[model samples]
Target: MIRGLQLSLNKTQKLRLESALEQLESLSSKTNTNASVAVADTIPVNYEDGVLKGHGTSEMEGQVVATVCGVVERVNKLVYVRALRARYKPEVGDIIVGRVIEVAPKRWRLEINFSQDAVLMLSSMNLPDGIQRRRTATDELNMRTIFEENDVVCAEVRGFQHDGSLHLQARSQKYGKLDRGQLLRISPYLVKRRKQHFHHLDQYGVDLILGCNGFIWVGEHVEAKDDMVVDQTNKSEQQNANSGGSVGSDDQEQSHTSLEIRQNICRIANAVRVLSALGFMVTVEVITEIVDLSSSLNLDIHEMLGAEFYVVVAEREAERRRSSTKKR
Candidate 1:
C-alpha cells in the first residue's frame, strides 16, 4: 500500500505507518466478521427456500459459493458478492465525474472507470443559453465549445442505451464542467451511492464531489446558478459585447483564484488521498476532521502526503472506528 505513493520514507516512518495499518486491520476484522468472504467460500443459504443468485456467485454441489473476494450482500431473496476492488457498476440517476475522451457527432465519450465508456449526448445536456430547444445543426457544430476533449465534467447517469452503452446527462447548472482542482481515483466499492454527493466546504472555498464511480473531484468551489438569473446575465453580457463594452484586461487579470484558496484546495485534496490510501470510506465529516487535524498541527500542505501523515491518519481512523463502535 505504501508503495502506491511516490514518496521517500525513512525507516522509522515506514515502521510507524505499517503498525498503524495493522491496528486498523485488527479493528475492522472485529466489526466486520463474517461479512466478507474469499474466493470459493461457501455462502450459507437456506436450501428449501427460493434463492436468486446475483453476480460473483456460483453454485457447486447445492452450495452457493463466492467467485470473488468481496463482501456478501443480500436483498430480499437475492444474494451477491460485491467485489472489494472492481470497476464501477453504474446505475440510473448516479452522479459521476469523468473526463471527456472523444467528441463524436452529437455525443461525447467519457472514460468513467466502467466496463465501457459512457456517452453524454448533446441533446441530453442543457445548453449554455438555458433553453430547452431541440438540438440544431449549430449546436452540433459548436459541441466542442461546450465540452472539448479532456475536459472534466460532472453529470448524472441517464441510463444504459438499448445496445448497453452507458449514457449521462447534465441538464442542471449544478452538473457541468469542473476546473481549477484535482481529481482522485479510488476503488469504486469505497464510495457508496448516497443522496448527497456534492459537498461545498465554504470555509475553505473548495468543493468535494464524491462521484459514485470513484472519481473524486476536489476543486475550487463554484456557486450554483439560477436559470432565470443565468439567462438574464447572458443577455446583459451579449448586449455589452454588441455595444463594444467587453470587460477590460485588468478585470480579467483579477479573476484568478486567490493563493489562499488554492492552498485550501490542496489541503482538502490531500485529506481525501490519505483516506483512500488507507482503504477507509471517504466521507465529508472524516475529510473535514482530517483537514482540521492538519490545520491544528500546522502541517504544510505538501507534508500531508508524507509517510508520517499517512500513519497519523490510519491511527486516527482506527480510534474513530473504535469509539464509534463503543457508542453503538
Candidate 2:
C-alpha cells in the first residue's frame, strides 16, 4: 500500500529499533558484558578487563584472555610448557632443568633460570639410606664427583622458603646424573609456551630435554660406547697440532683455522637470532641448517668452537687494513 513513499517512525519507535539493533550487534560480536546504558550513548569500556597479570592464570580479577601462544597447559593451577616457548611464573612441585654454580655442606646452589638461585638440600635427596646415610668425610671431599660446577642437572621445584627463595630436589628415578652431552641455554619465555619436556630425535639417536631454565640437553638417546675415548683422542689431536708458537709466529695457519670457526658460529648465531625474532621455536634442525649453509660457504665444522675461533673477526679487521693499504 505504501509503495512510493516510506513510512517514517515515531521518536519512541525509532529509539526501540535502535536499542534492538544494538543488542543484536552485541550478541553477534559475543560481547558478554551487559550494557546498562543505551547502546549508542554508552561510552566504550576497556575491552582488556580480563587479561592475565603475569603469564599464567591469576586469582586476580579482570584478567585478559591471553593464553600461551604455543602448546601449553595449566595443571592444578600450575603452568608448564616446552623449552624456547613463553614462560609463566614458577610454581611449587614444578620440574626444572638447572645448573650447579655453587656447592656447600648441606645444600647446593643452582641456577634454575628464575630470578634467584634455588637451594638443593642434602636431606631432600635420596642418597644412601640411614646409618649409611649422610655424606661421609670422604664423600664431602669429593663433592665434584657427586656434582661439579657447571654440571647441568634436572630437579624439581619443591616449594618456597621463608625468604622467598626456591627449594629444589632431585629425589626421583628420572632425575639425576647426566652424562656427556651438549647443553644449550635459551630464553625462559620460550619454554613456558611449549607443551612437552623431551623431544625425541629417534632417527638421529638423540634425546633432548628442553629445560625451563633455558638449558637444553642434546645427546644420543643411549650413551655411545667408547665415546669418552673418541672425545679424548680428538681433543689431544687438536691440542697437539695447535701447540707452541715461538716469536713472530705468522700464526697464519692458526688464524685461518680460527677464522673459519668464527665465521660459522657467527652465521649460526645470526640465523638463530633472526628466527627467534620471528617467534619461531629453535630446533636442532634449525641449527643444522645454519651449519649446512656455512658448509656451502666453505666453512669447516671441525673448527667450530676451536682455538682459532676469534680470528675470523680479526681477519675482518685485517681485510680493512689491506683495503686501506690499497688506497694508500
Best model number under lDDT: 1
- Candidate 1 residue pairs in clash (backbone atoms < 3 Å): none
Model 1 lDDT vs. the true structure?
0.87
Off by over 4 Å in 1: 1-19, 228-255
Residues 159-262 of candidate 2 have per-residue lDDT tens digits of: 88998978988775356655445566666665443456665554344456666665666544543233234565564454344333321243453233334334
Q: Which ten residues in a row have the lowest lDDT in candidate 1?
A: 238-247
- Top model by TM-score, which number? 1
Candidate 2 residues lying further than 4 Å off, grouped into runs, are: 1-88, 128-142, 193-195, 223-278, 282-328
> How does residue 283 of candidate 1 score in lDDT?
87
**C-alpha displacement of 231 in model 2, angstroms?**
34
Question: What is each predicted model's overall lDDT from 0 to 1?
Answer: 0.87, 0.51
Candidate 1, residues 144-180, lDDT tens digits: the string is 8788999999999999889999999998889998988
TM-score against native, each model: 0.89, 0.45
